[model samples]
Target: MDGAGSGVWNDGSVHVDDQVGQGVSADLAAFLRNADDDRPVKIVSSVCGECGGRVFVVLVDDVEGGAERVCTGCGGRAFIADSAEFWGEADPGEAGCPCGGGEFETAVTFSLAADGPVRWVTVGLRCEQDGLCGIYVDWKIDYGPTDHLLALA
Candidate 1:
């Protein structure tokens, strides 16, 4: 495990390495703040740069509040806004029983701030009560998936 409070941002958003989502989401904030070593969780992000390169953040835990993602590859940048949306879900096949016989899922949506060619990314954290899980974060260049790009910043 990375460190208890070390994984969460002071502004409430969870921080992963250059690739993880800070546990700022609503449902996972509390869980993230109080999570232990065995129960590890982090936010991820998908970013598309202006130069046509993709920075697929497998885990984003190093970013602090107000900081954006800068395309190390193309000079593209992403800034973390004052706030982001965080949602979670508990389903039967997701959060399994403690007996290691069932499976359960928990998801978290990390909404990044909009800027330049990269608008925002929604990342999900899925897991089983038994601690089995997966993570996904896809970047949306515009507000709408089909929306147009306004600038090249």
Candidate 2:
């Protein structure tokens, strides 16, 4: 979970460790591994802050929208808005899915500093209609505002 040696993937995909946590599917992992060089990127946290859970449900409505990560164990939640200063991108929802689907399922991961705050975050999206998965977006937290970004998990 250390930040060192992170964000170095040759592909733009974010690295997700399914062994440390559960819920990420093999197909989703494969899609992330082979992500296009130009695709968006982000990490996965090993433990939940509330109730010590290891499972979470993620949601991403649009590129210009915020995302939510909810802990299944205790119903704890974290939210982040895409309008945050760290994110500078247009809304990708206007383009819709390549298959013309408008809905998507989301997955999120984070790179944590060994002894500090969160260093990075990656959000992944899967098309509800076609099962296609890819990076939705990612951000680098240089200022170490873990609570602001994670909402204290």
Candidate 3:
């Protein structure tokens, strides 16, 4: 239980089956890996969907997989949304995109356990005006402010 609070997974960990799945195409992965200003796993944090708590990922190397959680405070389980649902709207300037583009796009991928529970999520942000982007992973803690509007829907 050295990292009981923080677990480590691979860059390609999809499906609860425990094998490995990148869940992203080669080109996209390459783009993120080569982002100008940042590494893929730089800063990935999220809120606990169960109780609205912060869950920051301590990624080693480049594990893009999502996180599975048993809400310690609420005694319930929570999951990260798939990349499709995890995308957040932001200005490239705010995200530190080197392109300084007017539009930024984020794509995420969610991992689900075979038992039908979600494990974790990976996110990639890119500047639509150019292709400057970055990548990261975070716990599916909650619908954080970035996702508050979506959570309401």
**Candidate 3: tens digits of C-alpha lDDT, residues 88-151:** 4211112335655433334343333333333444555445456654654444433333432222
Candidate 2 overall lDDT versus native: 0.48
The TM-score that candidate 1 achieves is 0.25
Q: What lDDT does candidate 1 reach at residue 89?
A: 21
Give the Cα error of residue 15 in candidate 3, in Å: 8.4
Residues 19-106 of candidate 1 have per-residue lDDT tens digits of 2332223443344333422222333322434664333122233232122333435655443221122112211122223355232222
**Candidate 2: tens digits of C-alpha lDDT, residues 40-138:** 233333245567664445544454444555555687765543334423443333213578764444445545665546565666665667877767666
Q: What is the C-alpha RMSD of each candidate to the true structure, in Å?
A: 16.7, 8.2, 15.3
Q: For model 1, how big is the CA root-mean-square deviation?
A: 16.7
For candidate 2, which ten residues in a row score worst on lDDT? 12-21
- How big is the positional error of residue 130 in model 2, measured in Å on the Cα after superposition? 0.7
* Two-way TM-score contest, 2 vs 3, winner: 2
| TM-score for all models, in order of appearance | 0.25, 0.47, 0.32
* Model 2 TM-score relative to the real fold: 0.47
**Candidate closest to the true structure, highest lDDT:** 2
CA lDDT for candidate 1: 0.31
Error of 3 at 105 (Å): 2.7
